[model samples]
Target: MSPKRPIKPGASNTSPDTPFNLPDVGPPALHRLPLNIAPQGEGRIPVDHLRTPVQSPPSHHAPLEIVDLPAETHITSVVVHAPIEHFFLAPNQLSRLPAPNALSGIRELGTQKHFVDLQEGGTVLLGIDSENHFRARLNSDSRPSGPRLERVEGTLTWRVKPSDESVGGSDSRLTLKRLRNPDDGPQEVVAPKRSSTSTGDGWSDPWKKWDSPPQQSSIDGIEVDGTRFLLLPRGTDPDHPIVYIKNPEHRVYDFDYMERILGTDLMQQPRGAIRVPPANQWEVDPNLPFQYPLKQYIATYFPLLSDTSLNKVARHQFGLANDGDMATDVGLTRLRQTFNDWKRGNSTPHPPLADPLLMLPTLATSISGSGLSRTLELPTLTPEGSLQRLDFDLTRQEWDYFKTTHSGADLKRLMASILNRQGYDVFTPTPSHYSPALVFRRKNHSFVFFISLHRVSKGRTIHQPLNSGPDAADARLNTQVGYPALQEMLQAHAENRLVWLKGGSQVHNSQSDSIFIVRDNDSRLGTLANL
Candidate 1:
């Protein structure tokens, strides 16, 4: 094409011979583009643009911001049955309890490191006085070592008072107060105390009451104060005493405050309880399935295998022995029957079998040289190697001897062990004597067994000559006591009065009067009672 002249701004390069005269029109506002001058020897081309930079509409939602509040301390209390003098004045004894300094992840104060700075009628530790309303102190000893380290000091205050629950009023209540604050030390402030008359008639004597204080003492320390304090009572020995410990600074960080102060593990765990070993640490072989014999299962579930007597018996009974030689044959048969009954539609009337495993060697007939038969006699022997008749019944003397030696607890333990082997979760609740019920739970099924040993009456009628038979004796005993006992257990289970057996089926002795098992079934009672 021939060379064309450059068009000026706002001018159009159109021929005058065009069919129609058209007006010049600038770029639409929506498609407007900014102009910039090009440098010499540089050329720029104009491109049609439609999108323009527009600010996004302000968001209707606000940005989330989290603000942490300062940690606040609280006062907690526990009552223990122990002598107040032994708990507070005896430094060696108090050191054995759980203290804040002994907690993990916190600095450990050495043994005998804390001293009882006894204030008038109160105790002070780490600059916190017991007489004040303060409950905690930021422990300085636990503070990390650094220039920016926050010097946190944890202080504990304790008071000793008489306890009426103690035998002959010998036990005392040791009220403990824990405090935590950013201040350098505990502040002295007067806390209002409830008058003896205002509290209650039972609490009129401040020293006798476990909760109320006798009087308010003048506190001399910092000016800041806390609203709550943990009061712990010392009534009995450390083994069975009640103690409470909690972290008031739970909002900021989680920790056991009492464990740190007492320098002992105060977590309420079962006696002889063992932590489950890691999966890798277990002796289970990868090639074999995780299954064990009944005896081994019991030993694994309970920590009783450590006992020398029980360990030997368990090994002999179930380890390498065949099924027929197992000592728990009677218990196993009963358990199997119960399971089978449950599987079937049988609701009740499933009485356990008699002692089928108990057998004695009898004399056999011998043949003479010609064909004449001769009677052979062999000495009768008992399971314990005693020279007694196989069918010999327990005499009054023997029964008395056994009763004097064996305890109800032994029976409870035996029943629990048997139930545990059957895959039942067992729990022994506190104040067990009141209910004396053992709980067994599995899946959605739960039951309670109230075990009691009834003394056999010599005058009771025995239809079967088998004096050693548990069934005959149990039947006679049941007629006298078993039914009544069953009724009581049913009532307790129905009322939910028993703590451990609450909300579960009641099981009574299906066969033996000495042992009662309750299955968790509400409708089965009528059937059971009729049976």
Candidate 2:
């Protein structure tokens, strides 16, 4: 006998209608177990014998999918009652319509022909016919949408009706068409040249130089060198071009060049002597001069002695000179005491008082002895029949040194000295400010100047006011902290007074400074005058 086998449901070994059965087992009496006795009336089952069923989460919704559509061409139309002249006057208004981009938007490409080219995104060519109708065609095979097309044709019809009693001007209807593929024409067409000029063709012919360099040939009376004409635009349009001649060659001319050319004086003064107004005057009140000892000092010092003479006097009094070695100590002591007393506004102890050599009477006598009389006389030409040439070689060297070595304060002093010598009353505020460093008054006219010295970089040698932060644009002197000074200067200028800004050299090693006179209409100091 074979080993006993277990049976499965619905197998060939078992009948389909037979009841499901378990395998052979031991007697029920042997498998039974005794339960523990609980207290009477309790209603609880054993927790270890119980089991819970497992559960799964609910299903989720699926995500969305995207789709793309093809681009479409758009067409728009408009109707208006306006004169043809009005449309011509403002042709730019037509470009405002919704259309493709243009190569050269609404520009006149031809002269007097009323022929204008309207390119559509570099792919279509449109032109205005003689009847004022718009004709358009695809200049290339490419289309904005779908596959490459063979051709495209479109028309913009402008139907106009004459003005009547009802309408103020002409009535016109403008109809535009949507671009579409055409069936009859060839593909890959080239755009027609919009302009007949060589420039309009996008490039020039290499052989065209034989015709006198194009547009310049039309210019009459002026001879143009090849290089010069090539640099300029080739057209008759009135665009002003400025040509700068840098480092021009110096031309040598004979002494009689002017005489040979004109045979007479190029400039002649009037027969009568032109009398100029006096520059110098008693700036301080002559009657009340005693109040200003400083003014007295200036007057006494200027006319009596040169700077060299003053230096000599100082050296002698200080015992620094060889000649002063023989002087007595008591005499030197007395001289020093007298000078100190005079400076303190007290009378000198010496009988002669202030140096007799510095007295006005003695100065006048010395001037007479030098053959310069008190009487004023006009200057005449020298015995050589030519005006005496001023020797400026030494002056030029001194100027160079002064420019390089002097500080801003030194420049201010120099300017003040020059103005005072020219008979102008120069004044500086007690508390000095950077802007408007000096003021000058001559008769009724007054002027002010802002002085500056800035370093140059990158080979730029000219001082530009706007290049400095404090003097540029919104930070200009007029807008700076000391606006009152600028206002005063502007007011003086408005009243026909001179206003200037003195700019020192821009180079570190140079001393070429300038005085820029400000103009009335502009913020810029227009002209640069040499200092």
Candidate 3:
């Protein structure tokens, strides 16, 4: 029980997982091209340079059939169709989209919020990327709205090349020798080949190979800048903490220079260093109970949130090289199971309430000084208006309509009423497109007020045959009127526009009566005393 020692300034304990902004050195260039397609023998063309053609191509005969076209006849071709995809936005999930900032690659188009285009081109991109949210319009043609979101049009190509170290290739370094425009942000710097030359403020080096095992600080190896040095903490090696530097920048702190400056033994340490495991460490057996304690187990095995080694380990041990695909449903399931096992928990929770703050009930204990509650308990609704779980399904259209129409104050009042009458309390957060429900109890009876929002569709329409049955026409008409009204009422009530569905008779006699239509200005609305 001693005070934790503070890391001395200039001391080397930098974790390997530190975010390294390495410069791009690979020859893969980002070029902006026109969306127009080129015919045989035509090279790629820039979009902005392209212009409308003066004349049309001859459709009668092929130029290939004849050796050459008549010199006297001027060949003219008009752009038949433009490659519209470049203009169209690419569809990607809202969650995957980076935060709206400089690094996100999405830039605002105008004054409108949530409307943006990709920086590469005029691709109209979605605001947020949660689940496959990118939709780009390649051309001027607009896509029809539907439940499934639309994406922008663009060809996103990614190539994964073998790392130079993995392939036994020399570390091909590219020194950003000189910058034509150093002050210009993100200006291209051309470094022809590998060598040590000073650039502006720091150095640039290519990312390391894929499979290169992290080296220990004490081990000897070839140096980047040909300088010699050794790792610190002297003979017995008692105090020097091993640090890992993945994706090191050679120009800023050239590996060799660091060794020379710090002293050959300790200065030239590996970018990533781990304490060499005990000479005869026990092998971990999956079947046997783990001997390593939980705290040590997590640090050594589970990798902390800030550990960069996790990236390398994931790539090697689990084939999880890419962060993008790690959160998939299958991956999430595996992660959940691992977390459960690590915590020694027997049960796993479901997707939890869509919006916990908004959906939970309000009680005297629920509210705080800041008007926030930590938990909400709701009664389970029955399927047949009996004792079942209360939930609702909604179509995209209905959801949109409700969000546009309602307010939070209206929703709170409605919840207050339901809780008093049916023994249920509701906690609605901010307005959203999701459907909300109420679950409450009465004397020896539990009821769930389930509200579902759906689009008007043929299948949902009640069938009414001509002269087939007397009640058929009335029933169909009644349903047609009641369903839409019901949707309208629910939305209004949810939004706080209306408080209660009132009728003179306790039980509704007419369709309108049975369904409490909103009376906006009824001064005689029930107080808590009535319930």
Candidate 4:
């Protein structure tokens, strides 16, 4: 049977007709036996003279065997240092990086995108082999005018599985973990990359090649010659199978512009510097679609999903590293005192995917490390590509409100003004024909936002589309002639066009594009640019 489509308001599926099928009790004759009648009245037939025999319990010859749990399994681990920006922005998908050749001397299976749950910090790592546990630290020295570098530690027993389309082949997963932060020591700076040539040209913001390699390395290191991008000694990750190169690039260069170099801290996890496998060994590409194995896995094959599921896989909770389920104190704890901090909520432990509210604090912390807040401009995707935040003004929420207000030319101009602030060339066509369609053009992107205002109930604070009861048609429409004709007119330029039916209730529609609007809290879009 075909599944039902979305039901319109006031529609009913329950029918007034009686059901054709009914219970069967073999007519009035089987209703009751003679002496089997209820105590209230005697309808008298004795019915069966003999009763069925009861089944006896099993004898000693046929005893039941007790079931028991099998032997315990140990979790193996390995740490990955990832920068914070790439974890959150732009073509924000984790690359399907293959597993290390050998983790702590054990040959383990590898999966693609080992770091999808790397939401907050680089402190997490792969699970450990029961035989060998890996422990390492990146202890940085206290510099003048700098706060004590709180030792960033690794998370424990991370088991990450990828979706079918994940770069690491279908249904493959990785188990990883990082070292603990309990160790105390003076700044322990490991050796730098063998050559500064790694960062001489266009900077390798997130990942860089250190010793230029014998030019190649592989997951198995077998017949795969010229396998692409030899691994860099991912800084001071003690649990790293090999720390051939100390730092990917100069520590000073990492915060140059996060996402562009501005995302995570140089050393630790949970904002830890990620291991970027550049196309070659010497330099890393700071942009997406950079190279093989580490390129972004855009979800093109999947059908348009409801707004909620847009980020379901990339941001859903995998087995968290801090659930504290394991008995042994092998990860980030000493004295064997492990509690489910996430459940108790004593403190905010790292969640598999960082929510926007949680992201506020971390981003602010990263910004503090970045002296570039001097311009107060936010990093736009590429090199020096940034939003001029000093004078430009527009929180995405306000832009949405003004776009749907429908207040003649002033409303149109205000929408245009918001786009202009972000350096877009905004234009309002005559008649504002797209239910007041506004054209926004910037760089290579040209977008026509077909905005429709959502309706709200009289006393309720909630917003909605296509109001129900007594006033359904009273709700404003998408446009006078509606979307079909409008869509046909702009079909040639369909790629750049968009639907802005407000985020309130309109976002629930499966076809509406899901966008991340920076909330108004942080000095209001002046800090977090939507560009």
Candidate 5:
């Protein structure tokens, strides 16, 4: 039996079977403005009809839904709000928010569709994307250093609440539910939703679009840049190992980009943003079930990290033509998923290359190092493995708290703790309001991290220090690493106070290599060099 199509709840005359459309706002849909009034209605789909489908409906794509917001119709104008506290941070999941700055926009509660404003002037953006995680899932493969995939002795449920929650059926039902971050992070607890329901379950998907994601490399019509977003392999598409799709256009890469492909603005991804790097055919690793590369240029330029942010200038170079030519965005499941699809029309399968390094030189069969040589250990480099590495640093509780915190001081302290654990002799000097700083010594090297943390968790920007100098005492940063508010970082040789403050343990300024550590609020860290 086919599943029932959902329609917005509306007037008594509206049929439950008929799908509903939102009343059109002015020009292209900006999704920025908040609805002054919500349409009140009820949806009653018979349970038997919903249960008719034998395969799992992938409604909502598990947290992040793959929706292409057209240029003219997508980006919305939203008022940026400060970080709201995660309820778990409160004594008993009870949180108190300060006075409302302003109601920004309606946000979907259960899915990753919430548009956020990290600051007063921040604009929310969207685009189309694809991911490829060419993973080797052979059960026989094992790594003693890697985490074992076994059941744990604990469970955590948590979620982030956009101020004006867009209605969702799944979250609206449960009074107390265990929830998790979209990625493999900690979980938290939340109250029942305003869109109340008694029928939703762990298996339920109000936005069921697919039961399981396709295994094939999905080519998207577009991509975005200037923002970062993580893409974990969701599912597979074995039927079409290589595919070219002008997949729903306007696929935004960041979980946010362009002023035109941006919010409240009617436009496609900006043409002047950035350009993609050149592609090399040998990058594809065909030894696996799917087509992907063991060592590729795509991952090199992008850097193996926690996001799928593509720059607008970087598109159209990967064998793509037409407006949606570079279809590397819809990739799911592996490295090949993202770029292999982009190379589709021009890419072909090649046999695995066999090369070996005999450490024993193959002279003596019974040599002690006879079996020392091993094939490239590629599992650790897999996309799945790359994302899992982040799970090591945080729990559901800590990660959620980090997101909602407005205290730069909190970030400084957290940074201190993390470094201390990593064998750094951390000395915590009092942190300032905007320009918080931390100093530590590892071995002979002593350094200061002119640190800037996101004012809000995972917001696009980190809070840089004021442009004022030490001459302006009060406005100057307490621990002057020496950068204006606009300057990215203060170098090691640029006036050394931190090391001297550490009981006169100052080393040569250049030897310190005082660095800039920035937390993007996305559970990822970055550095700024002073070259």
Candidate 6:
């Protein structure tokens, strides 16, 4: 016999005359559970044995506050706005840039932009708009600069997926913790590609190479700026993986302009300066003094370091030296350390720590180093390109080993143990009452969990669409309807109830598009508390 359908309040199923009624949960709660559906009494009809209609709650008992949702809530829609401008400084060019002053009405600009001096301090301008437009003197520096103004507008649409699609053959291996439908359509996979590969000649942003080899079939894209741009999977491609221009009418030169606007002298420098060269080749060094750190380097030299790429000069010129003794490089090390401190919220804006470019590599290195494991084992399907089948049973010893390795150290030891025994990966963003998450990702799908610590009422709410963009509509529907339905299903399964509990959720709003699962009820209290 076919499995009986689960009842969801207020949800309109496709089947005609379906007996289920959409439950009137309560008011619009952001990031919290919306329903107050009580547990069925002992005399209540078993879902499968049901014959009578499900009764609706009275007009009262609605919640006053929003209940937070499980960490696994998948956000479906997101909107991102990027302001990019680009320009090429010729023998003669002059223009003013948007002035930024944080002390007064000019606060932080959303995702700041920079004015790059392509040449060595060769650019010049004498004006900026503060509370009012005023003449400002450009600082003298070793790097070249030029006067130029370039503008471009665009929007970016992106999605994150599990595994590097290109590296993990279609039929890779998967360490299954949950059973899901096999034919649930093609799962989105992230195809990893090496962005900057030096072919012994020079550094290559493969995505930019006109004749770049296609690393993976899955790495694809649509024409947005009148050109076909391939989207490489994150962690594998350039730091900014999802890139495209909204206006195709503008020439590709605009992309160059945008590139100049986004590129910071701090991030890009002559490759030779950063790495040591072979015996046969000439080292690309501009021989600039003390290689002023990125902040001071950009400020003094290419004061417009935040703007664009400098000359294709030498190694020392760019301060990208590989002397292997950064430990003693006072100028370089100090700049890197200052930036690291700022990114970690350890310190405020100090005189020398204004620009982040100076300390970026160190900051990123720190984040990468903060993890518990030296190597993380991601589940694969088959070594070849094909869908993988579960060979190991949940009770088997192999499954236990897989669990302990993947589950990191956290407060929920019992849950961690159970999860390991079950062959699942568990994690939480922030662990506390006000914190809204306890997620799980298995076989590339996400699941989110929400719990009410207090039987009387304490809990969090899940907001819909999960974004604060202009495009989101009636925030209540996405958060209220979508989240509760999925959460209720996952919560039911965690209680050991036998019912259909499918895949996981995606968090649309995070620096890294994180995969998650729902975990409800604090495991510390041995028994399942009253819902």
Among all windows of 10 consecutive residues in model 4, the one with the lowest summed lDDT is 24-33
Local accuracy of candidate 4 as per-residue lDDT tens digits, 1-531: 101111011111223242211111100000001111112211111111111112233222211122232233221121222122211212222122333233222223354112212212222223322323322111111111111112122422222222122222222222211122334334233222211211111111212223223523332121112223223223323453221222222222121121121112211111111222332222221222111100011021111222233223212221122122221112212110112221122222342122211222112212323433211212121113221111122457764775465454444455445445434454443343333334343332233333222222122122221222333221222233234434432542345233232211213232322222211122221211111
Please, what are the lDDT tens digits per residue for candidate 1 over residues 320-418? 222333222222223333333433323323221211001112223343445422322222221344211112122355334445544444444555555
lDDT of candidate 4 at residue 316, scale 0 to 100: 22
lDDT of 5 by residue, 1-531 (tens): 101111111122233442322221111112211111111212211121122212243343223222333333322222221111100011111112222123433222334332222121111211112222111111122311111111112311111222343433333322323344468377454443434433322112211211223432252211222222122212233242232211123343322322222232111221111122232111111111111112222222222112211221122122221123222222312233323332332221210110000000111112123333211100121223111111013345655665566576776666666555433455554646455555454432233333333332121122222222334542343343333321322344254312211100111223321111221221011122112
The candidate that wins on lDDT is: 2
- Estimate the overall C-alpha local distance difference test score of candidate 2: 0.26
Compute each candidate's TM-score over C-alphas: 0.18, 0.20, 0.18, 0.23, 0.20, 0.17
Alpha-carbon RMSD of each model? 35.3, 46.7, 25.1, 31.5, 26.3, 34.0
Which of the two, 1 or 2, has more lDDT? Answer: 2
Tens-digit per-residue lDDT, 145-232, candidate 2: 1011122234222222221223223232222221222442443332222111111000111111212345544532122222221121
C-alpha lDDT of residue 386 in model 1: 21
Per-candidate total of colliding backbone pairs: 61, 0, 67, 43, 61, 71
What lDDT does model 5 reach? Answer: 0.25
Candidate 3 lDDT, tens digit per residue, 1-531? 101111111222233454321111111111112222333211222212111111233223211112333344322221122222222322222223334444443444454333333322223433322344443322222331111123233423211111122212333432322222334356343433433322211100111221123453334322322222222212122332332322222222332233232221121122323332333211111110111111222232222211222222222211121123222223222332333333332232321111111122222113234433221222222222211112222245533544454543333334435334322333332233322222222222112222212221212121111233444533432342234434443454455533322111112223111111111112122211122
Alpha-carbon lDDT, every model: 0.25, 0.26, 0.25, 0.24, 0.25, 0.24
